[model samples]
Target: MSGEVRPRRADAQRNRERILEAAEAVLAREGTSASVRAVAGEAGVGLGTIYRHFPTQEALYQAVIVDRTRRLLAEADRPSPDPGTAFLTFLERIVVHAAQKKTAADLLAGSGVDPKAGTADVSRDMRQAIGRLLTAAQEAGAVRPDLRAPELLALLCGVCLAAERDEWSDELRRRALDVLFDGLRPRPLS
Candidate 1:
């Protein structure tokens, strides 16, 4: 009688990682609907192998989220000399790059995903980092002291949500963000 298929080898495990990496590139650069078979081909693996590692669409999507989280966290950990500028720049980068990564770009599109589903903790950490910057900025009178973390995140959500379907160019987005920042900046009354 024929036996069941054997488990994958070490090389097979490495190949699976490569496939996931390729899938990430495709999904981020393209969209969430990228084909699994196409990913296997890109990874130089067979269809059966792709099926072996991730048997379901949800599994693949989760993997994409986890991988993207790692990448974003790594980016967040990069050295920044100024906490305030870094905070604002990080938020701006998150907004622009959200549309650049398929997993997050789609999430930013209001796919009805739970805000803290997989990446909530990472977000909380990011907000804490920004909060520290916020405090520093307020002390320096560069930003309004009344602003709160949740409020800031909500405003960012608004920017990402509105910008997703807009016809604005990158330059336009940057300029528009500058306008938004102008409103948020502290000003002395005459």
Candidate 2:
């Protein structure tokens, strides 16, 4: 036989996707203590199916984190007509993800998974993306000229942690973000 690897079977692929989706939701709702059995029930699959796809809870949670981060980065890379809107949207999504995945994150931290696995390159890419968006918005006069990418990243981290801690509702989160975004906007000369 050749040393080539093969793709997953169609049904198996579907099951895997279903399992990840269910795991994402369960982990978000139940936090770090979320069980593979609960994910199986949520996905309408058997425990064997979950184990077949994930083997361990840490692996499953890590996959979920990687998948979600990849999706978020993809959206951040998309071009938008309004630079400010794109920047704000990206930050808002980050906050929402943090708030939703707090428990999942804790689980990874406690599971000896390093919790940062699979994110180093993604983090660099994210910083670059944020820089581009921030520069564009600043050039468009939609953001403060003095605001730097590092500062913005730090602020984003702060907001994300706060959101995760406070567990804000969707409405409150939007309102709070609106306030934050407004603060980032350029001020008119007196």
Candidate 3:
């Protein structure tokens, strides 16, 4: 065989991506039980193409979950100033992203999908990030100085819930962040 890479798998790979994209779109617009025919229609591909890539709806669903998880990890990697703001911003982005996908919204209800992907020490890593912000806020007298990262994450999840409501207001997000930040900051010296 020549040293050149073969193109035989290109069409198959494209078809697979199309199926996954369609699954994400359909599952987001519809729900986890979205019909395979709808997914294929969204992808503009034949039914066989989806079937060939994902033999069952479960397999397709799992693939879309993993793909979205990867995207979440990517978004989490963005940089921000201070740990508190960074964590809140990251949480905000993820919550908004989740709002776009019904499957992920369903994930909030104890689904198997990894909530915090990226590493074995996800908790430690995130805590450290939050800790940094907490420490800074405390030192600067901006936050309560006693809030823990896990607690903060729990609040962030709460914010996600608030964000998921039908009202869809950016002000709600700001208010939620403000509330969390207020409790997380240290009291000013008398």
lDDT values for all models: 0.67, 0.77, 0.62
Residue range 15-125, candidate 1, lDDT tens digits:
878978888777665566778776776788887877778867557766777666656656666656665576677667767766565344333333234664655554555
Worst 10 residues of 1 by lDDT: 104-113
Give the alpha carbon lDDT tens digit for every residue of 1-190 in model 3: 5788766588899888888888888877766668988988999999888888776777788777766665665655555456555555665665666556644343333223354442223334443544565566556555566766557666665555555544356676667666765666565676
Clash list (residue pairs), candidate 3:
143-184, 143-185, 143-186, 144-184, 144-185, 144-186
Which lDDT value does model 2 have at 121? 52
- In candidate 3, position 189 carries an lDDT of 71
Candidate 3 off by > 4 Å? 1-10, 78-81, 103-153, 165-167, 186-190
* RMSD of each candidate relative to the true structure: 5.6, 4.5, 5.3
**How many pairs collide in each candidate, listed in order?**
0, 0, 6
| Candidate 1 structure lDDT | 0.67
Best by TM-score: 2
Per-candidate TM vs. native?
A: 0.70, 0.73, 0.62
Model 2 Cα lDDT, one tens digit per residue, 1-190:
6877899999999999999999888878777578888999999999999889886888898788766777778998788899988888877877888898863223212212343455445566667777888898888888999998656777777777677777889999989888888889988896
